[model samples]
Target: MISSRGRKIFVAIAGAAVTIVALLCIFPFWMVVIGSLTPENEIYVRGYSLWPQTFSTEAYKLAFEDPGKILRSYLVTVGITGAGTAVSLFIVSMCGYVLQRPDFKSRNFFTMFVFFTVLFNGGLVPWYILMTNYLHLKDNYLALILPMMVNVFYLIIMKNFMRSIPGALIESAKIDGAGEFYIFLRIVLPLAKPALASIGMFIALNYWNDWRNGMLFMQDETMYPLQYYLYRLLSSLDFLKSAAASTIDLGDQVFPSESFKLAMTVVATGPIILLYPFVQKYFVKGITIGAVKG
Candidate 1:
């Protein structure tokens, strides 16, 4: 019903807005990619540019040349993420299912207990001392996995979602001679796929990106995860000095620090980027279900 001129104007404004937002989201990634390809000297002299002035594979080559460290870090991250996600999901889903049951006498008390921890955390110093002295998880991979096993926010969201399911369904399963665990695993979990998927991705991202635990607990170079390793490489002048010092005999084959950092960023981010599309549907579905119900 609009005039041709008005329709054109509306289309132009909408297209311009979309283009601006898209560019804002995409420009940093584009810069990182271009920076990775750029020569170190050019980057150092000229600063970051929208396009690489002089392209080179030296950064990627350096990253892969002694890929042993990077590969080991990747394996550690993958293992932690996989194992942590599985264990945490199991625990969260089970706890949430129980808490959601209307007849569970202690459900209100238990929910308040969890909600209390969200607002009041044991401070960092005491927690650190406990892990190091009593728990003795220092320099251990379990330090990464065990500490983050349950997120209260995720638990609450899941419990609320589970509440939306009919109580008659649980009663019917119980009448069929199903035990609590059996009903939870066989009946509840199958119906809670959307919530599980969303929480799973959240847990996976947490485990994958975790470096604070690694930095605090891990002293051994071999125990370092990818992010912590990259952190040390980027932040420590002594570490870079030692690396460059060790390679001094190679003469003109020095590590490209700037470019290599960009390459590492790409490596660290690549898997999650690839994984987003597959898990995104579940994420949206889970949020919608939880939000609408609670």
Candidate 2:
């Protein structure tokens, strides 16, 4: 048996190791925040520092120059994330529950079909045509929400998580005159909270960070999601800088490009970072749930 002294020593080492790892993970983001406040010239001169050599809010000012657009984009992103996560979660969980049922004879076939899509898809041109020409999703809010509403990876994760639920519990619910939907809602859902929270967070993040869909299907400026809006803004700044440099001799630190990048990083990631702490407990549980289950 290990002695108490050895255990205490081990604990101390483990705590120190965890602290170091945590700092390592957080240090890049901390540098980004500091660099955003540092002047572009100062960044070039001194490089990124824990403390800025010369502080400036120029990057943030540039970012917020058109606060109205940013606010509109924020609203659009939040709506898409909230709606998409909810709809996707419901569909994934229900499908997972249904497929895991032993009595569901077509489960294997259906599971194979879902898994097949993961390995092979019809490619980008067909998908684009389907979304635009066939589905009429161009410039539509459904353009943002519908395409991501059901992720095959999330469905697989949900299925695996649901498979861990004991058949006896479901049978007992049935014996108590519970319908399939009732059993799924009352028993399976509560037990599957961890998986649901994890997958919901994943889906929300996907919607929040998505720019490709916006780039493809959206034309209206008012319809831009936060990520896409910021991307366009940044791209415009870069293009102007390039054009001006080509014609007139604009100085090296003219546009606050580096700091603007850092600032936008801060802006884009702030909400999700704030959100993570609340869902982290469930996320941790979900990752480890059913790990040992056959």
Question: Which candidate tops TM-score?
Answer: 1
Off by over 4 Å in 2: 1-24, 40-50, 61-66, 238-258, 290-294
Provide C-alpha RMSD values for all models, in order.
Answer: 2.6, 5.1
Q: Per-residue lDDT tens digits of candidate 2, residues 42-132?
A: 8888888899867898777766664555678899999999998998899899998898888999999999998898899999999999999
lDDT of 2 at 190: 96
How well is each residue in 27-127 modelled by candidate 1, as lDDT tens digits? 99999989989998898889879987779877777666567777777888899999999999999999998997878999999999988988898899999
**Clashes per model (N, Cα, C within 3 A):** 0, 0
Give residue 292's lDDT in candidate 1 (0 to 100). Answer: 44
Candidate 2, residue 64: lDDT: 69
Cα misplacement distance, residue 171 of candidate 1 (Å): 1.7
Residue 32, model 1, lDDT: 94
* 10 residues in a row with least lDDT, candidate 2: 239-248
